[model samples]
Target: MNLSIFFEPLPEALFGGDDNPKSVGGYIAPFLHSFPDWRSAEVVLIGLPEYRGTAGASEISFQGPNLIRKELYQLMKGTGPWLVMDLGNLLPGIHLEDTYLRLKEVVEMLVDEGKFPILLGGSHDLTYGQFLGYEHLNKTVSLAIVDSQLDMQENKDAAPDQSHLHRLLLHEPNYLFSFSQLGYQAYLTPTTTLAALEKLHFELFRIGQVRQQLKEMEPVIRQADLLSFDVSAIKHQDAPGQQHANPFGLTGEEACQICWYAGQSDQLSSFGLYGYRPEFDHRALTATTLATMVWYTIEGFYQRLRNLDFQSNNFLRFSVGFHDNPNKMIFYKNRQTDKWWMQVDDLSGQRPPMVVPCSYQDYLTAVDGEVPNRWILTQARI
Candidate 1:
């Protein structure tokens, strides 16, 4: 795709002078002297320095990508064959939409080549670009977003960072199959917005709900093809670098755990971490936090398992029959990973019955002669 023309090489000085052979910087093939051979890499890192999507277009935000790189490079490397590449900073285009187009092209190329793309960003609005990458993939997509507030602002004239979710949800061609929002603080989210998502049969996890049942989020994340995490989802104390840092949100550790879950998902193809502002950072604490999240995600990626084969002996199957409905619900639990899945009849009748990721709780719910909410939602969508 001739990607070199769209990116600028990382500054030599940003490459930490850490001499330790085990450091991540020593292992990654950075685009310093020349473009790294991304074709041979399993994970590719792209730095987005475009802040025009937000108000005022702050130039200070341009340094955000490198700030994260500085902390990331100093960390110790994870388990073997670290085929990672730093593609350096992506140069913003003349217009904000133009920048989005550039990002869409890069992501489409990388995903088409079977490589994971992790976008380190200047603003959350770039997720619109990330979503656009899947437009030509010829398949439906499930998207998971983690943020303090739903970005689906009603004002059409609002900045893209605030209104991008609206664009994503209403995007033409209707390729989005599912959308889930995690770690949203109720106080920050309006009831109207919540009701709107409910009408669409989408899933949402309030911040309190997420903290109370963190493990339950795994299946929701596992269902996603793309994930966009806004740093505002983290408490201001843990990530003070965000422009709109909230006092209450996910902890740094919780954020990393979510990233780990996303990384391990067999369906997830691209991830974007956004809303980092280096100018507001405190002693680089937020930078370190984001870097560690990236590290955990990469580690989880290496631990990823291939698609499950239902007929195999590695899974245990269970059947729960309904008395009144005369339909039986079938469930499968992975012996190796302990993940659960349930079979649901496609109400649309256009395709075969779909097997979707579920939680242990859902299986238990079905055993009690009740249909789980997950099953209801999946059917409603169909």
Candidate 2:
């Protein structure tokens, strides 16, 4: 229960640099000096300094959270209560996988207390810990990963970061209800991997599609219980901090928008932003950009309206039934948020039907007498 044992405090200079008492950093309480009474806090920030699993990652990442705080502390905090606290960085384990295990326990502890943990650090493989956190708590969850390419390698000897997805999908207790990936670059993702994901019924939103219909992704992020963002998904120009910087990827603004949407989601419980290499970050632009993303995420979380009642008056219901099928597709639109959900019937008698997050576009698809994309995928999984 001594969380400090696994964590190292923010560098004295980083947290104690300025005498100015008005910046966002001024409002944050590091668990190093003060263990936040998480019951009173809405969100917690934690950092990890591991990158051993990444193919060619560096030890410079160990200083990522500290560098991010340099920029984060300079940002302005919103008007409401400052319920955010930082737990510094997780002390690395003897083995890279050991760090993952430590992170899982830390995340589980915070999640159990209803504290949303925003992982402001780590390699792409760190999410395996985030996913394990849910398993440790015995909670089934949907996952959303924002990356440039699929991290599914068929190589049996692949490192933890390379084949983490394959390992996660095969993880036991089978708590992964659904998995959605956003901002993957088509050229980077292999055709075979795409086919495999499609066959398995996971959702993949290409970078071009997301940029064109960015606003529509709110419902998609809302459906997730945890999010893992790989900085490599951002273009080299916008986020050059990635070791595997892509020439084509999301812009800084687009990334912030996605994080804001994640923050606004009622179902989102955990978040991890990974793949930032400070050594490659010129002028610290990527760090500042990440700070902005985290800022918007926190803002969205504070502004959540908490309306998710599909059967209540807050939602307007519509049903589409075709003469040929004798089955109905039910859609619910929330009056408060204008978000949508759909009911997929479970005919197998094994489990009850599921109402999953959807967008107006899906409704339009159903109205055209076609199967909605999300519904088809959900059914395939069921």
Candidate 3:
């Protein structure tokens, strides 16, 4: 793949100055060139136009990059201080595993230059590749996944829509830290899969729980090293543009809050917004909402990034939950003082950041013991 020659079309609204953004190897060349000589940038927004990993979403998701870009441009017409470069699409036709490796290479290049990668995804399956890319960053990578379904299918060949996550789990990378599964529903997941995830120490939070105990959800998001959002996590009513639209899920506001939390952390390097189907979206509301979510998430991110009080604490938190009893479980935060530590939570027991305004009752509910609130982190410095 001659990455330097990839041609990507950007929204006309994204144009700035005399130098037009370039198109490089299936990516946006102009966006890549927008940074200060590629050595430093606040964040890089790239679209993964490839949807092959998702059986039902491949064709419809091709419109994802363009749709999100259009919506984002409109939302941030006059926004400031959030330096974002839009690198367009990781196209289809490549092998799944190979695609993962290629995405890894691209992300590694950006990380090497110290640019945070904000991917507008083709599907949630891309997380495997994103994680693989982080393996070489010399930093621990925590995963924050917001989705209604766990995608934890036991059957390897079940529809790609339902199994992208299962494939990711199988290829656990060395730098992979904690995995926080948010917005998952009880019915969408099975008892066996839940048990398996529990044994592995992955964190789980239902949409209902977050709605009930919003404030406590901040720790999980803050503790993540990277964030991955599948729009299906939002309800079908709220965002029906997804291939796998779930009726029981987060509202638009709640979905945005999750992204806001992830954006608050300086240590949270990589971020993505995935799973939008322009065709299924009746009123084009889904694409608009998806775009808005990206902006709000970025807004939340920049708000924290610009704060003078912002501290750089790269902690990875893993939450475990009981299937029958969601409250009966453990909350683990792995803070590496020196070297990059992946899977460190299993070996060491570091404490997570304490909730300042929240009490024990609030923490339990936020952690799956109770229902979630509309607003999760109200006392955030940003």
Q: Give the TM-score of candidate 2.
A: 0.95
Cα error, candidate 2, residue 179 (Å): 1.0
Alpha-carbon runs more than 4 Å astray in model 3: 1-3, 11-40, 57-61, 77-80, 305-382
- Which tens-of-lDDT digit does each residue in 228-308 have in candidate 1? 999999999999998876789999999999999988898899999999998889899999999999998888899887768
Best by lDDT: 1
Q: Which ten residues in a row have the lowest lDDT in candidate 1?
A: 53-62
**List of clashing residue pairs for candidate 1:** none
**2 versus 3: better lDDT goes to:** 2
Clash pairs, candidate 2, are: none
| Model 2 lDDT tens row, 123-185 | 888989889988865657899999988899879878777789988999988999888899988
Per-residue CA lDDT of model 3 for 1-382, tens digit only, reads: 3444333645445433233222111122235333223343466777787677777543564767777776566553324366665665564435767777778887777766767778887777787777777776675566788887788776767766578677667764555555778878888888788888766666788878888877667767766777888888888898988886678788888877777777666667788777777778887888877777777766666656332221345534334454666343322232442111111121122544332212334335545644323113221211
- Model 2 clashing-pair count: 0
Once fitted onto the true fold, the runs of candidate 2 whose alpha carbons sit more than 4 angstroms away are 17-21, 56-61
Q: Residue 351 in model 1: shift from native, Å?
A: 1.1
> If ranked by lDDT, best first, what sequence of candidates would result?
1, 2, 3
- Regions more than 4 Å wrong, model 1: none
